[model samples]
Target: MSMSTLLAIMGLLLSAIPAATFLRNLPLFLFQPCKANHAGNVKVSVLIPARNEEESITECVESVLKSRNVEIEVVVLDDHSADATADRVAEIAASDSRVRCVNGKPLPENWNGKQYACYQLAAEAGFHWLLFLDADVRLSDTAVSNLVQRMQRTNVALLSSFPHQETGTILEKLLIPLMHYVLLGFLPFARMRMSKSPAYAAGCGQLFLTKKGDYKSAGTHEAIRSSRHDGLKLPRIYRKANLATDVIDGSDLARCRMYRSGGEVIRGLLKNATEGIASPVLIVPFSMLFIGANVVPIVALVLAIIAKSTLGIVVATAAVFVSLLPRVMAARSLKQPWIGVVLHSLSIVIFIAIQWIALAQQLIGRRTAWRGRVS
Candidate 1:
């Protein structure tokens, strides 16, 4: 309303530029999938933890086997899938020994399903390196070799990659990029690998590559067996163990569509959003900030224009554009649709709401399901 407040708003808007620049390196892979290639002979135990991914398991297994040059022993954990997921993996495994389907043991007391399943898989695996992949992920031909080479180049114990999403539905298009953008802002790629902070470690669940020993030394899930978000925990654990770790933008090397429909997308996000956010106290503040940053700017600009507050209108418009630009760039880089940026940028509202919903669920002692397992 006044000159001082308008100037203050402008200053806050301008401050985002430096954050954008610092976070600019996050979209590490613009044309990443095309860059995949086999490095050398490195045996990798490609592990998949499938619960009820029957629809996607067939293609996922096929994609893993289609790799060009790399020794791979694919282990798909049938984590008590009630659906035809186990049958599907069995059928694939029956045809090829390279792709073996292993039944995940029941969730033992005090252990999370994924962690227990992974622990079993690791115990059964006889390989030099381990690669943990989600059942929805479809890999490129040279994905393994490329990851190994990147692993070798970085001299790190763990090399994680953020795969691109294959946005088929409207829901997938809107929400998935929000996941990555928050990850980008919350923990910038350059800073995570460069610094040794465990809080900053981020790995895509779709792709987690690490030396077998490094995995074991980090106590694997034994350290955070209770964690619902391994992607958030593993890299940090590895870093704390004095093992070098790095993450790459794998938009090209791997692709996945996490949920089938909008309702499913909302539930999928709610399952972990509250647990995944920084803290309980930050919940409301973050939600309000999210809404204010995205929706307020546009509404404020319109109101300012009607009220004839020239500086207010100009500042609001500039803030909205500046806030949305990097995320638009992120969506484009991730191969999400052009118009998806609008939803992706506006997603901060949905993001905060889902998180609160998740927190409410957790408090009620209700377990969330993903791929048919309690998350």
Candidate 2:
């Protein structure tokens, strides 16, 4: 086979792998596991680890207070913020009996700040079910109630869901939606649901639900104290302890604008990179798959047209279709911007670039800092 034909074949195969996974997982991704017939009577402690979240603290607390059909107490652990995060929580506490603000203890040696705050919050919680929610995430009125119902029904030890990512800037539109694409495209939802293996464990740290007893037994945040990416870490910890961890659809139930600007988005992703796809073992393989599947086909298609290679054109066209369709479907289902659909390939290029950059930083012993803390 000609080199052009060989490249086209490679692209077609690589693109089809993720396309198949996306198709198989699309229904599971879009399904609202939070919507159910039974209203939750479960009492849950909604724990928020706040550091410099003054702007969103009130809104986050108020939204949780709006949760219906469930008994919930909102606990905001102020992680020694430079802002008015504690004051805002205190104001809410004064008005509402269910809301309380607690000052977080000093960071322990080798512990990630957020993880320590969560450990403290878990200690203060006065309920059987504990929910570790991010301060920026705003839950719908029925979100907590329905989430509990689903967790109880499934009998999973830990449950998490990716909230609706609200993006406004051009860079945000291009980058944030890739989270869903990477997740639904690569991770097999069926295997994740059927196994307690740490290999299949996946979650979102923004929202985690677990029974208090299970969390204590699993060692919770203390087990992964130094790790920044709790989404993957916490789930693996649970699975390693012979417990099941599952991810559900939260796009309809909660919304969060993770980063305010493009710079923040880059830094935030960099901070999360080491524990995810940016490691030495995973980076090269992912780089090959990402470039082969998304970039090669488009370039080969144009070259084939220029050279009039019919075989190259046929396989390259199939590759392009298979690679692009998953993004289109995800955009529609997740309510992502249309811009991501038009520039899917470029987005992958930038996404992979960030991963490699993160890996380089990790190797050199340089750490990315966030919220006045270094990781």
Candidate 3:
């Protein structure tokens, strides 16, 4: 085949893989299970691990306090915050009987700060059902109730939902939606549900719900004490211990702006990289997949147009369409910004670059820092 033809074919293959996977997973993601009918209220301990989260703690606690049809005690672990994170929680606690702030113990040797805080919170929890929520996450009045009902209906040991990502800045709009794209485009929902394989494990760290017994049996945050990506590691640990975990669409129920400024966005993603796509085993293959799927098709289309190759244009056009369809559909489903859909390819390039940079930093004995702690 000629150069243009070869490039076109390569682009088609790269684009088709994720397109097919996204199509397979989209329906499953959109299929929110029917809420199981119950008589009593869902009694859950809403656990929040906050380290320098003063700005978000009050809102987080208030949102949980607003939860309807659920009997919940909100426990906020103030993890050695230099700021007023604990004071904010305390302020909320003073007005509400269900809210209390706990002082986190000193960080143990070789433990991730967040994980250590979560472990402490889990130990202090009084309820059977536990929901580990981040300070930045805001839930609708019915979110906890719906989560409990859905978990009861599905009968899974752990249930997680990637909340509706709220973005504000231009960089945030361009990048944050890729979280959904990566998830739906790669993970096969049918296989994930059918198999308890650790390889199929996936989740969002911002929101996780599980029975206290199951969490303890699976080793909880203690199992992933040193790991930064609890979402991935915790799910894998549960699966390894022969427990089933599942995810649902949580757009209407919960939302979080994970990072505020562009700089924060970069650092937050970097902090998560080594545990995720930036790892030694995954970095290279994922780099190629990300580039080929997101970049090559656009480049091929440009080249084909310049060269006036009809066959090239046709194939590259199909490839571009195949590549963008998933992002367009996901943006609509997840209520993400349209700018991300438009800048999909560019976002992938920047994202992949960050992954490589993270890997390099790791190799050089450098670690990610967030909330005044290093990972």
TM-score of each: 0.91, 0.97, 0.97
lDDT of 1: 0.74
Each candidate's lDDT (Cα)?
A: 0.74, 0.90, 0.89
Ranking, lDDT, top scorer first = 2, 3, 1
Residue 53, model 3, lDDT: 93
Model 3 weakest 10-residue run by lDDT = 31-40
What's the C-alpha lDDT at position 242 in model 3? 96
Collision pairs in model 2: none
Count of clashing residue pairs in every prediction: 1, 0, 0
lDDT of 2 by residue, 1-375 (tens): 666788889889999988899999989766464445455468899999999999999999999999988899999999999999999998989889999999988898899999999999999999999999999999999888877887877899998988999998888999998888888889999988898999997889899999999998788899999999999999999999999888877988899999889999899999979799998889999999989999998888888888889998998898899989888888788888889988889999999999999999988998899998994
Tens digit per residue, CA lDDT, model 3, 16-111: 888999999988987353355341556899999999998898888999999877899999999989999988888888889899899999999999
The clash tally of candidate 3 reads: 0
Q: What is the model-wide C-alpha lDDT for candidate 3?
A: 0.89
TM-score (C-alpha) between model 1 and the true structure: 0.91
- Where model 2 places Cα greater than 4 Å from the true spot, the runs are 33-37
Q: What's the true lDDT of residue 19 in model 1?
A: 39
Who is ahead in TM-score, 1 or 2?
A: 2
